[model samples]
Target: MLIEHLTMEEFAAGLERTRTVLVPFGSTEEHGSHLPLDTDTMQAIDVGRALARQRPIFIAPPVHYGVCRSTFDHPGTLSISTETLKALTIDIVAALYRQGLRYFILLSGHAGGTHMATLTDAGEVLLQRYPELRIAVVSEYQLAAESGRELIETAGDSHAGEIETSRIMHARPELVKGTAPAEYPAFPKGLLVRDKRRFWPGGVWGDPGKASAEKGARIEALVVRELRTLVEQLEAWQDS
Candidate 1:
């Protein structure tokens, strides 16, 4: 069940069954010419909802901003610093723990390196404060990447590429403007440039042409299955 829609009594009842909660984290960064800015957020919460249907779990409201890099120069891309993200994450976990939630799944749809690091770091802090609490920081991509490896044709399909395009197509079709041409950035190794958009103008990392709604549906199902496993693992954790 979605925490926002649940009454306080309903939430307390859910807690009695399962103390675990999934908090989706996504970014307000530019996806490409086609996908919506909230692409990551939409995919994340969708997975959370699907998982909830399979089990009695509560899903917290999604955190819609993240530490966006590489695409910072792209239009409509908004970012937060690592410090801010860490602070927000820790605060959220602290609040939830006080509410009797003991298990946390910080599910981020944005797979940026900096963003994921901040989340894991926050999980560490939460653990230090409450050693008995169970927390897992993850991105759906990390759980389901190999599952889609065969389905995707792009060599390094990431960002607003074939896999993402297909997933978005399946999740929110009307929001997709149109398919973007296949493109990749040419950033110099170990050198960060000021005009990042110059290196990656189209903002597409793989061939979106290979994307199809059929493939997207399969991918979403795969993600949900993997996430279910993760939830089970978290609940079964035992401090030795």
Candidate 2:
């Protein structure tokens, strides 16, 4: 069930049955020229809803705008500062912890550096503060890596690549463009450059030509399976 959709009394009643909550984290950024700006958010929500169906977990409203410093060069990309994202995550989880929800599963769809690091750090602090709290940060791609590589045609690039585009196709097909050009920028030949200006001139990192709804469905299925297993394990831990 979604916490945002429930009334105060209803939410409280549901919490009495299950302390586990799933929080979907994503970013609003340019997903190449094919996928929609909300592709990450849509995928996260779809996975969260699927996980909720298999277990009695409350689905918190998604943090749609996250830290995407790498993609800030792209137009229409809305990224928060790293510090802001960290503070927001800490505060939100702390609030839920006070409400007796000790188990938190953070579902991150965006793979940007700052967002992933902030999530891991904040989750670690929360777990340390509340020993009983089982806080886990799950990257859907990591969970579906093997399947994604085998199923997706373009698997190497990180941003707006086949995996992401396919996932978006499955989650929101209408938002995907039919004829979008794909480009794979050559890796830097010289020493690594720290400046965004030197690298990633087009605000994208991967080739999106091989994206398909079939691959997306396969990836989504794998993620759902892995997440369900984790949720079952958490339930067993709670019982023990």
Candidate 3:
């Protein structure tokens, strides 16, 4: 259930009984021209809610800002430093840890390289400090990318591509405008860091033209199935 929905007493009781919490790590960033800026936050919350339905887990309020240094060239993108994101994540998780929540499943909808690394570093530090804590940083994009490799029609998805657009279409169709054909820009070899707009001039890395509600539904189903399996494994680990 959503933690905000619970009273103080109910929240305390839930912590006493349930050992796990789902945190949605989202971002307020540019999602091309068609999608909304809060796409990442919306998708992450959707996944968190779905997971909450399958088991007894408290859904925490989502983190709306993320590390988006690459997308700085975009007008609507708001990004935090990697250090800031890492520290924020650690602090939030630490607060929950103090509340006796042992398991934290961070559902990240934004998949920036630096963002993921910061989160990974934060998870490692948290684990080091609290040996009993079990933290899992799961990315919705990564899950879909790995599992839907064959299913996604786009060659590669950098921002508001088919995978993202399709998911948004399925979840919130009103947010999507008409899509257009897109092409990938050639990147400098071994370029460590650069503005995303250089490669994605239109703020889209994948072919949004191929996206459809049916495809989005199929992708969500697959992701939810995989996440369910992960939850089951976590439950078994807790029992053991």
Span of 10 residues, lowest total lDDT, candidate 1: 140-149
- Is 1 or 2 the stronger prediction by lDDT? 1
Cα lDDT tens digits, model 3, 10-29, are: 98989776888888898999
Worst 10-residue lDDT window for candidate 2 reads 196-205
Q: Tell how far residue 165 is off in model 2, in angstroms.
A: 1.5
CA displacement after TM-score superposition, residue 225 of candidate 3 (Å): 1.6
Per-prediction TM-score, please? Answer: 0.98, 0.89, 0.92
- lDDT at position 152, candidate 3: 86
Compared with the true structure, all predictions reach lDDT values of 0.90, 0.78, 0.84
- Evaluated at residue 106, the lDDT of candidate 1 is 97
Which pairs in model 1 have colliding backbones? none
lDDT of 1 by residue, 1-240 (tens): 899999999988988888999999999999889999999888899999999999988899999999998988899999999999999999998998999999999999999998999999999988889977999999977765777767878888888889889998898999988899999777999997899988999988889999999999998898899899889999999976
Q: Pick the candidate with the highest lDDT.
A: 1
Alpha-carbon RMSD to native, per candidate: 0.9, 2.6, 2.1
Model 3 / residue 16 / CA error / Å: 4.5
Candidate with more favorable, higher TM-score: 1 or 3 = 1
Model 3's TM-score against the true structure: 0.92
